[model samples]
Target: MARSLTAAIFATALGFSACLLNAAPAQAATGTITGLAGKCLDVAGANSADGTAVQLYDCNGTAAQQWSVGSDGSIRALGKCLDVTDNSTGDGAKAQLWSCTGGPNQKWSVSAAHDIVNPQANKCLDVTGNNSANTTRIQIWSCSGGANQKWNAPAGGDDGTPSGFVVTEAQFNQMFPNRNSFYSYSGLTSALSAYPGFAQTGSDTVRKQEAAAFLANVSHETGGLVYVVEQNTANYPNYCDWSQPYGCPAGQAAYYGRGPIQLSWNFNYKAAGDALGVDLLNNPWLVQNDSAIAWKTGLWYWNTQSGPGTMTPHNAMVNQAGFGQTIRSINGSLECDGRNPAQVQSRVDAYQRFTQILGVSAGGNLYC
Candidate 1:
């Protein structure tokens, strides 16, 4: 049995309207939709064509199974809504893809029992005949509060984080095959998990570019993740700017270039620490000691700092500002304006390689 009518009424009142006919709107609830026997709701053969059948398949982290549950009540995948066949309300009516029309047949709400119910039909989305086999058809059926109708929908839209992480572990290994003494693949993975939103500030393509841009810069800075701290010990002491109010809590000579992007300066450590909820201002060595922390600091710089550039590296990549802008953002004063073409070229080369690996175009403006 489905939940009581009062519960259904409350869900309807919560605005489970069908999606409008535009590009699939940004979703509030998005993730893999898992159903009977742990199978996922998959678009057949990763196809996005209208009328494609949505079936149950093995859980593979592909775009076909990536669903965005919109606030307007449409469950969408590959930019189309999960719609009923000909707006049929009868039990066993097969579900199919259609351009979203905000129709009653497309408006679905999850009941207290966790059934995905189309209110107009007052029936739950069920695996056809309660089958759990791969390629099992999905249809509307009388609510039985069965496990086949139950699903798990995590919160937040797919902004290309883990679900859309374009780089593979093998690719990462190819980029940093030897691995730094202090940096591990696990560390990078942890950082990626901790800041899943990193480089996801824009569309899927932008996200890939941002990730590539950031890795390219870090590769140039660390000699392919080979070094944990800056090699020039003399410059370490120079990074301790005495003008700030904090006055280098880690000591006069503590602030130095360390971590993936070689985070430097007392103020920078303070800022990265504050953003990551670590006491980096007081324990500057933590950046070098903790691999995950080190990567986080690098990502912190990528996502938040504009440095000598007008925008953050993340913003630069996402806004199609060109890779040269990222160079300006990182070290424009010294590298831009023909100051250090060789160094700039090295970063660009790495970026190009990464983009090639990611199968994305490097866009334009390779130099600052």
Candidate 2:
């Protein structure tokens, strides 16, 4: 919608991101810093030279990949430190295996956000061009929260995220860097039980496309997952319909947007609750308070409902109906067919970017 960013949103952005690197400093940390495509940070050729390029390689449990994080913020491997080449603070500065002298350039902070930041440069450890191919040299680039910048270093997603999911925790973090922790990867995976075939019904490419489509639409609705409730107070009391037989039992204002897909209206709560075997009509607050329930509501909408379009988003992608059909299913009435090109473009852009992150083609029919 190209909605205005609230003063409250701007004011809290800084403070909210202040904790990205606030994890207790790695104390003799004993793991590899995993990055793009699940590769590990490796020293080229296992060399101990002062300027050997630090690169991404397939994790082989090798000594070159094994790193011990220092209390003083040095990442050491092969008896050398992960140093920014020549103490450079510039973007594209190559990280190298250099003799540790505790230079500010050698200092690093492993963040909970899955970033290994060189505090001196204020940049994130990045794979040069979002490539995950082995031996791709590593460098420092401005923090973008892209998959190339995520690392499962000390206290990162590897510690808390579940394994075997199509979307790795690092990738999820990359997708919604500013998201509330309440929209957790664990919570999301837990809710997947409700729709067993979602993201699992097709070929690998189709699966990733479905996942990207769903999340792209979700990102639009929730503002990259940063917003939990609808920001417009004026619409709060208007979602209720007195004409329904249930008659907005939760209260007039209670049916306003909430959760990832912003499930609203009295009848919607009743229907979602009935399908999910919960009492959302009478206990709508659960959608806002319970992370699992919140994720489930979003999933329910994606799987079962075809609000203003001809097909469910799930069937659109899995049946090779193309990404545009998914958009039609989600918001065709207001945003499709040129009614709101900007909003439609926003969704398409997100879908393309997310499919790229998942290493899949976004496919055609990207607009309705």
Candidate 3:
């Protein structure tokens, strides 16, 4: 009811995206479409092709299940529209849309030549598209610039930026810098250029403090993004049980790591996925690969979690140490101790590099 209208509104808004596409168009259309050769669900099951109503299905890898993305931000399989299932455009529908008229929900972006960004949600569209033969589906996700979202377009997608290309690393660095709290360098510049809401108000000292804290945690957790896997774990299960409260169980199975902190558990995945429009149960890697999802999770943790005093400073300061604490709280368990003494010490080296980059004293107190 309300959800359907929301999707309609989203679709209508997309009709006007072309107007806003001027600021950063090339970044929006950088990917290519691989036919939906391996995009179908085998468990619940649905097969969508041109002109046919696309339906939901478990990963089965059938001939009728192939899908392809287009340079124009359109999704087509068997020559049909990859639409929202039931034509319902609710805020939290699983990635189970069917073939229908090319609406905004069906429109997507290939901003990175490897990633497909969905402008409507300001995130990337993923294959849920694991390399597996079955259990693959397409869904909108945050932009991680991971391979899943990236597509190698032969003719390339749109290039709407005033510069005739998407944002460059220099431009991105200028706009986001090491201090910008939330800025991704994709074609999102157009959408974000006017988002005065993204302005930072902290003093130079506070900015340094915040950036140092953010960098420390980011360095410790991701080894500065080096520890990240080449491909995002897109096919992991959502792991929800109907009887369980909020569909997340209360045990080890429920709490597996995800994203930088690798916030685990079916509950967290469900919550995050619901907000982001992907079915967490169907595709769990949204935590890692989706840039927007990762950012959302990071922000959620920084603002809402508390943890042990030893691993991170989640409870110490709301600014930076607290953010670090959220990481430790989420990923610093003995069970998931992938970081060794040497690796831990490496964070210090990384923090030094961070300070040099930002020209600030990265408080050595939390350094590995």
Identify the candidate with maximal TM-score. Answer: 1
Worst 10 residues of 1 by lDDT: 1-10
Candidate numbers sorted by TM-score from highest down: 1, 2, 3
Residue 198 accuracy (lDDT) in model 3: 16
Candidate 3 lDDT tens digits, 1-368: 01100000011101112312112222232222442442332222334432233333443455444444443455444434444544333333335434444445555544333444444444554555444344455555555555555544434333333422333345335422443233353423332221111111122333334444544554445434333321233322332345646554343343345444345556565655664456764566555456556555544443334332353232232244533343344333421245534544444455456555556555434432
Report residue 290 deviation for candidate 3 (angstroms). Answer: 2.9
Can you write out model 1's per-residue Cα lDDT over 66-184, one digit (the tens) per residue?
88875455688888889999999999899888888876778665432356777566678899988999999999987776788888775543432343345666778777776676877
Question: Candidate 1, TM-score vs. the true structure?
Answer: 0.60
Residue 51 in model 2: shift from native, Å?
64
Of the pair 1 and 3, which is ahead by TM-score?
A: 1
Candidate 3 colliding pairs, count: 44
TM-score of 2: 0.57
If ranked by lDDT, best first, what sequence of candidates would result? 2, 1, 3
For candidate 2, the C-alpha RMSD (Å) to the true structure equals 17.4
Which tens-of-lDDT digit does each residue in 1-368 have in candidate 2? 11111011111111001111213323366678788898899999999887999999999998999887755556788877888998898999999998776566776655544667775666788999999899999999987778998888744212223333468888999999999888898888778756645665434576678899999988877888887777877778877878878898878889777788788777888888997889999999998899989999988888877777788888888778888887777667766888978877888888998999999899888898
The models' CA-based lDDT, in order, is 0.74, 0.75, 0.40
